[model samples]
Target: MESTHHQFYELFEQLGLPSSEQEICDFIDRHPLPGDVKITQAPFWTEQQAALLKELLKQDADWAVVVDHLNVALHH
Candidate 1:
């Protein structure tokens, strides 16, 4: 199902983030990852946040698709 907002927007909601267009955009701008890092490996996240993201990916839970979309957005 195509999302009404950006895929990353859905991921943020599922992740319990700000979930606003401007906020998510600002977040990405503020926390850019290095060329070799994965979103899950980004340094900005606390251990709990990282674990949550990892769990989403590992479980392929309801939010996995959106999380994967976010991963791509962050990686590139």
Candidate 2:
């Protein structure tokens, strides 16, 4: 479990931040769904996104949405 935590954190660290909303959205659109996906796992990623968003966008729109954009960029 701890390894998984570090892995994800490292993943976010490597991703840095998204340049724009469209970049994020495009990434998300292209991202593939997990084989065993579930909504309950959503919140687990929120914290990571918020953390990255703070580092990247700073005083931008809602952190969650910014993170969503980032996710999009990362996936797509």
Candidate 3:
């Protein structure tokens, strides 16, 4: 699971944020999913980030595998 978390590196880098695997984890820890909001809908995402997330899930893209890992992390 920790390794799967690193799969977000390319995404965070594309967003021009701290892109290290550890930094991404830290960010997730800092900005948790709101009770009523989906992880992809969390305000921390930019429009592009949101869309990418949706598209990844929609198409069952390779990234979607890691995104699903993240969704699980968000819940617990």
Best by lDDT: 1
Q: Report how far off residue 40 is in candidate 1 (Å).
A: 1.3
Candidate 1: residue 33 Cα off by (Å): 1.4
| Cα TM-score of candidate 2 | 0.28
Residue pairs whose backbone atoms clash in candidate 2:
27-72, 27-76, 28-72
TM-score of model 3 (CA atoms) = 0.72
lDDT per residue for candidate 2 within 1-76, as digits (tens), equals: 2321223233344456453555544545655546354322434446665455456445443444534544554433
Across residues 1-76, which tens digit of lDDT does each residue of candidate 1 receive?
A: 7634336777677666898899998887777667788878888887877888999889776677777767766665
Which scores greater on lDDT, model 2 or model 3?
A: 3
What range of 10 consecutive residues in model 2 has the weakest lDDT sum?
1-10
Residue 39, model 1: Cα distance from true site in angstroms: 1.5
Residue-level lDDT tens digits of model 3 in 1-76: 2334336677677556798778978887887775678867878788988887888789776777777777777666
Candidate 1, residue 42: the lDDT equals 88
List runs of model 3 lying over 4 Å from the truth: 1-6
Off by over 4 Å in 1: 1-7, 14-16
Report each candidate's C-alpha RMSD, comma-separated, in the order given: 3.7, 12.2, 4.9
